[model samples]
Target chain A: MSTGATGRIEITDLGIEFSRNGRTVEAVRAFTLMTTPGEIVALLGPSGCGKTTVLNAVAGFVAPTAGQVAVDGEAVAAPGADRGVVFQQHSLFPWKTVLGNVEFGLKMRGVGKAARTAQARTYLSLVGLIGFEHAYPGELSGGMQQRVGIARVLVNRPRVMLMDEPFGALDAQTRLTMQELLLSVWREVRTTILFVTHDIDEALFLADRVAVMTARPGQIRDLVAVKLARPRAATVIATPEFMALKARILTQVREESVRALSGRRP
Target chain B: MAPAPDGGWQRPVRRVLSIGFFFVVWHYSTKWDVDLYVRFQNIPTPWEVLEEAAAQLRGAAFYGHILASLERIWLGFAVATVLGIALGLLIGWFRLAEDTLFPPIELLRPIPAVAWVPLSIMLWPTERSSIVFITTLGAFFPIVLNTVHGVEGIDRQLVRAATSLGAGSAAIFREVVIPGALPSIVTGLSVGMGVSWICLISAEMISGQFGVGYFTWVAYGIVKYSQVVVGMLTIGVLGMLSSALIRLVGWRCMPWLPRRVKDGG
Candidate 1:
């Protein structure tokens, strides 16, 4: 895979808090991580472990309460084209067609109509959504909507793509197909990605590194390197090495899940 | 036995039957000996009202009254739509605008449009302008408030997504804010149209020299109770047509909304 230059994410002592009903609730605290250019890293944790919060911080959606998040040595402040985000829910504008949604970023940048349409068409085909260009988001199935979301972000050619469980809402069969589709896309356009999910299998299948986080007030508890060979097939999950890694990660995640169930604050 | 599914003719048949039932009740009620019937004894029978309506429809004066009422409503409704959308977008998007403008609007919104008649008459030199002003007031609040609600209710993630795609505030407002709030805006328009008709009739009754409302009032003054019923029926038909037109426009603009919702199911 040809790795594109420009994507490198760094987070140092990142903390995020939400004030609800005049009560301060810390979502993430003292979290720190780094990704090399074109690296695929997954933030794997329990449902409310602030994995999405960390991803949002990188996407510049959430302001860090403390520390800093930077991309390519530049401090993250506001959302920009350099960092594209794919939300868990299908956030495609219902009013816009699939092609229109894909071309939105280019339109924002003032790209010419002909050029942007060509670029949008290219990305839509990349996600295998060529014929459905004129369809509205509401008409598509869950998996198809997420594909449009992916195409929309990819058209921007972002340095770093922050996906917050992009396929979380899909059925198992579709999720598997999407994972494979993502891997293929990543092979062609090697942008750095920070994928967030509560699914252990998804994290292992997609990321070069999986950073497992704790329960509420989440902090990185473990970072396991998936040394599995590139272009790994879906059959890799059945291999002995994959099983061994799964067992190890499962034990660590189960410990945190137990703590969360017991009403313990991390 | 299970009921048969409705056939093609069922809907029209049901409609005719319901309307026929109303006329039958009205016909008998007017002739009743009850104390309630005594007060309504002067009210015309269904056949008398229909005959008066037929005579009015054949005359140019009736058409003139209809045209005048329509002209006033169109002028007032057009002004209300433009001003309401502009002000609503400003109030919904900018915090400073909201804080500054919303309080006064909230205070004035509760005052009925008819209550503005006295002030409207003094504010404008012409009777036509005064009636238009009162009609504009009726349509404005619903459109503005619904638009504000539409803007406020937009999903935050959509805005974030647009911003992350490098959309500036202007682009976001045009591409995202407006389209996202459209469903509610259309709802506002439908409601605004209804209220505008109400205000138009009232204004015409009070101040107009040539309108359906004025015709009804004059007929009552002359004791032409049959002609008054005809005017009332004409207003009802016109009001229904106007609201339906607004809904049709809304449907065309929003193709993404479900068929059921667009049809107002």
Candidate 2:
């Protein structure tokens, strides 16, 4: 059930390099991926595989040294409201109440106070945080804070939502609950999502297509499409088809992680 | 944090008893004319100081001195607060402002307030203005430095998040930078309040016709030793009250801080 027809993220021959202490370090090389108008794609790989670097390029946080990222036929040169990003943790403004944080985007866009408040309340309720309107970020649990982060981004209604391991910091039980919550939210909002994560189950459970990348100087090694049915539950993970896909992906991830460790030696 | 002293009236009673024990020791020390490596023989007894304080409390002139010192401190502190926070925000958030403004500040920050006394007296037309100038200079550095530290210490990810949320540069500064730096700014204000008093008293003692500092200096000159003790006590009490006022305002502004954090402050 696609709700938006505008979020078509296109990355072409993207490469990113960082210079540190007079040394040139290539983070992502020839890493290219594209998404259809309401697709959820997970960039899955081992830690330091530059999966996050790829996502950052799409979010316009880091400039690509070699190619370009375009959203809906327009080149992305800087961060904009059209693309919203949810960081892993501590992204919410500590000084702001939950309601204020959610309304920040509308406030920045110069929306009048009453309209923004109404819209913010709507999204906060969507994330099941109606009673915590005036609570500060520091007072919430990790999972609750991430929910606020999601609502904050969704309220902006960006063409694409970029999440960098948003649930990675939560406990395992909380992460599972959040994944389910996110799937339900996605079913309604239907904006394109580019999720970055290292967890195999998480990548398979939440994404329509998982783009697996090789370790450092990361490149897409495989693009596996999840043929699993919609409205997936945790029970679906124990099924044979899910198990088979998990086995294949687990092998690839282990190989890449080994290679990544060995390559660190002098 | 020290188990919160078990949360009872015992804490307050113990505090009173602790101060009372100190008074008892001081009274006996002067009464017995204790003279070891340290000398309490010439010191005023606690009884004599209490008598002087009672006498001073009844006089209108004592209230005038208190009012004069408080006015100087308030004026200097208010001006320093405005300038320090404004300049600090600009300096901390903008590279150009930092480069252009910080070098001169760095050069001047090392000069102590007492060192500026003679020059400030010469620079300003009035004794009052010069003393205020010293007080302002004393308070400004801590506030501005702490504010800059606060701004620079903000997480880079927060700015990125704000930008992605459609915030322009001005909006990021207002929404993220200002609020992020607020806890530290409050810390700066509290520190600046303390430094303001120290500078005000030093300036007043050096050259002033009124104020507690001047009253204390004149008491020593006239050999009103008990009055000198009373003035010193007044300065201590007033400084404590001013700090409490700052802590109160700090709590009011940052309601987001948890109660534990509020207590730690």
DockQ metric for all predictions: 0.80, 0.87
Q: Considering summed lDDT, which 10 consecutive residues are worst modelled in model 1 chain A?
A: A1-10
Among incorrect, acceptable, medium and high, the docking class of model 1 is: high
Model 2 segments more than 4 A misplaced: A1-4, B5-10
Which segments of model 1 are wrong by more than 4 Å? A1-4, A263-266, B1-12, B28-40
lDDT of 2 by residue, A97-211 (tens): 9999999999988899999999999999889999999999999999999999999999999999999999999999999999999999998899899999999899999999999
Worst lDDT 10-window in candidate 2 chain A: A1-10
User: Cα miss at B129, model 2 (Å)?
Assistant: 0.3
Clashing pairs in 1: none
- For candidate 2, lDDT tens digit of each residue in B1-265? 6665566888888899999999999999999999898998778998899999999998899999999999999999999999999999999999999999999999999998878999998999998899889999999999999999999999999999999999999899889999899888988998999999999998999988999999999999998888999999899999999989988888998989887777666
Question: Evaluated against the true chain A, what TM-score does chain A of model 2 have?
Answer: 0.98
TM-scores computed on chain B for all candidates:
0.93, 0.95
For candidate 1, the lDDT comes to 0.91
